[model samples]
Target: MTEYLLYYWPGIPGRGEYVRLVLAEGGADWIDVEREGAPDGEPALSDILSDTSRHHLPFAPPFLKHGEVVLAQTALICDYLGGRLSLAPEGKKDRRFALQLALTIADLVAEAHDIHHPVAAALYYEDQKQAAARAAETFRDTRIPKFLGYFEQVLKANPDSQDWLVGETRSHADLALAHTVDGLTYALPNAMEAALEDHRRVRDLSRRVRALPAIAEYLDSDRRQAFSEHGIFRHYPELDA
Candidate 1:
């Protein structure tokens, strides 16, 4: 068995890709449980989530099962794996700093997803088209600039004066940021094109991450699932403007 078993829905990068990026960079021995497990991925995930016998049951997918540990939420999972895989900075405070950034990135991701499903996640896009368009305008004009610019300033103001997001080296936070940038650019091409022009450091950091040997290889592999309408960063034409 692989050292790590990742439970996430199949067919879309979604929140799971953020976890995947750190795993790729760290070269951790891991497997996508649903993709490699039984054909009914949801049932398998539910089995684990609903396992009352387990003390640590995750409420949703994108959880990782390693040994007797089961971790949910992207930030927590990345923090755990990054530490074990040597992708974390030393010191307690610095690790918390990385988590802080990861949480912010998570906030941005949630907002992006809500753009397409502003009314309700349970409602279809067609049913919420008008609300989504309204939401998209604000997201493209406000939220994107806010989150991306915040990260750019964070890189610029790194006390260590390094290109990485935390301390003097790359941590899980940087990987999360890189994946967030990719998702944003994919979901909002026109807006991101304009937004990225001013956030040069963030853009460069993402580029550097993508150039990492392991990350580049994983990106080129068949395991990499491309962004789609079903995922968080859905690219709706009306929402693109």
Candidate 2:
């Protein structure tokens, strides 16, 4: 059995949600360290980071410790777990396709986060309301479709099948696609619905991922955090056109 330890701020999903989705999909047992409900705060986070005694010190949250190996970056985590759990493709070309899909997911995730904090991530939304408003408009009108369209194209061009992003089997990219759709819908319901008709592949992938037993259960359970203003995908009526 492979042991997995996940270090992330538990309250808001944020980037941590990506790791959670992958772990859940893979049915891997992992610890969500530094959770709000946990005993300590910065001390625990710091302790985890400061323990230079351990060979693996991740640079950031959403980092995973599998056995003796520790890895950072959500895409790398996904790829690592995909290989460990056989969630990725077997062929080299197909693996590269999976990696490319992960990269695309990372791009969209960053853009989604910037929708609320356009100028700087360190600054609060209130501090940069004007900039956020402008950024939100740009994201709503331009960024969303451009990224979604690219995924749609990937789905269309996949020679193996149109159901999944890379190979005929479901990969980590498929899971990322589901999360992206969910996040977009929560953040911009009208935009998602309006754009849904245009991106059939994405819509289909969303539906398929939701139909998965574990994903469906997770969506209904408290383990899955809801999107809110405090989260990356914030719902600001003013931000929406």
Candidate 3:
């Protein structure tokens, strides 16, 4: 059996959730290293960066150590795993479309992160609460609609003969869309509800993806992490209208 070692902060969903969704959907065997807050959590992220002894240092958490290969970047990791899991399309255009979908997900993920820390990633959410409040409004009122609209178009235009983002069967991109929708709903329920009213395909896609056996099982299991204050998508009632 093949094994994958995924190193990520066990607590926060962050970017790690993207990789996790793919692994769960593929039913891939993997370890979630640092599986929650530790009393001495591997000497803080900065300390780990200072140390060079660690083999194959990843630029960040959510890096996958697949035997000798070390892969980073959420989308790249998904693309690599997609090929390994035969989730990628065999056709040239279909494969390209899959990559495009992944890129779009990345864009949305960044935007979501910005919602809580709009002014700067360096500043803590507490420090920038005022800015984040304003930013979240813009995101809810303008940004989420625009980004999800793009995804809506992709699914509607879906060059292939399927309901998924690419190819006929579900791909990493489809899983990604589901995860994004789930995260947004958890973080900004009001905004998510408003956004869904316009994008029927994305809303339907999210529901269908959640109904998948493995995903349904994962959601029910203790292994699935819940959204919290420290995560990328945070529940700020003030931000929601």
Candidate 4:
């Protein structure tokens, strides 16, 4: 059996949460290396991300180490894992659609994160409060509806099933969308409340994703990290509608 090692920031869920969700749903044997810590008390996340000697160094956290293969980027990691976990659709076209949906969810997540740090990710939110406010207004008013409505259409158009994003079975795209919706709800509750009222299919898919046996169990467990200001889906009161 190949034991998987996930390298991610210890505190916030961040992008790593998506990979964790897939692993949990697949019942894969994996260890969150950063959370566990090293035997010598060194931080695992920093060690791997900043390893100068490694040929394929990841620029950030949420990288996965599967034996000798180290994969980075959230969508790419999920795409790789989807094939192994059978979370992707069987057909090639459907698999591509699943990946496309997951990538779109990634874009939504990036926009959600940007609402708080509009000036720059390196700068503090306080330093860019004005810009963030502007960004938040646009995101809440326009971006949310556009992305959520697109997802709603995708669900409505899904021929195999309206419950899942790709086919009759759950796919990685569904999990990604669920996480994105949850993040949006956290970051912009008032906006999401209104948006979801119109996007019934998107909302229903989110509920269905949550109701998955493994997902529901993990959500209730301590292993699942709570969303906070430090994470992508930050709940800054002023930034929300």
Q: For each candidate, what TM-score against the reference?
A: 0.96, 0.91, 0.89, 0.94
1-241 in candidate 1: lDDT tens per residue? 4787788999999999988988899999888877877433333677897788888778887998877788999999999999999888888999998899999999999999999999999999999999999999999998888888889888988898559887988889998888888988898899888888988899999998899999999999988999989999888878987
Estimate candidate 1's alpha-carbon lDDT, on a 0 to 1 scale.
Answer: 0.88
TM-score of 2: 0.91
Model 3 poorest ten-residue lDDT run: 36-45
Runs with alpha carbons beyond 4 Å of true place in candidate 4 = 38-43
lDDT of each: 0.88, 0.81, 0.81, 0.88
lDDT of 4 at 215: 92
Candidate 1: RMSD over Cα atoms? 2.2
Residue 46 deviation, candidate 2, in Å?
Answer: 2.4
The candidate that achieves the highest TM-score relative to the unseen native structure: 1
Tens-digit lDDT string for candidate 3 (1-241): 3377677777777888888888888889876766733232234434444558877567887787677677788888988888888767778878777888888888988888888888888888899999888888898889899988998888888766447887788888898889899889988998899899999899999999999998899878877889998888889888886
The stretch of ten residues in a row with the least summed lDDT in candidate 1 is: 36-45
Model 4 per-residue lDDT tens digits across residues 142-209: 99999988998988889999788888899988999998889889988888899999999989889999
Residue 161, model 3: lDDT of 49
Q: What ranges in model 2 sit over 4 Å off?
A: 36-44, 52-56
Alpha carbon deviation, residue 191, candidate 4 (Å): 0.8
Lowest summed-lDDT stretch of 10 residues in model 2?
A: 36-45
Model 1 residue runs over 4 Å out of place are: 38-43
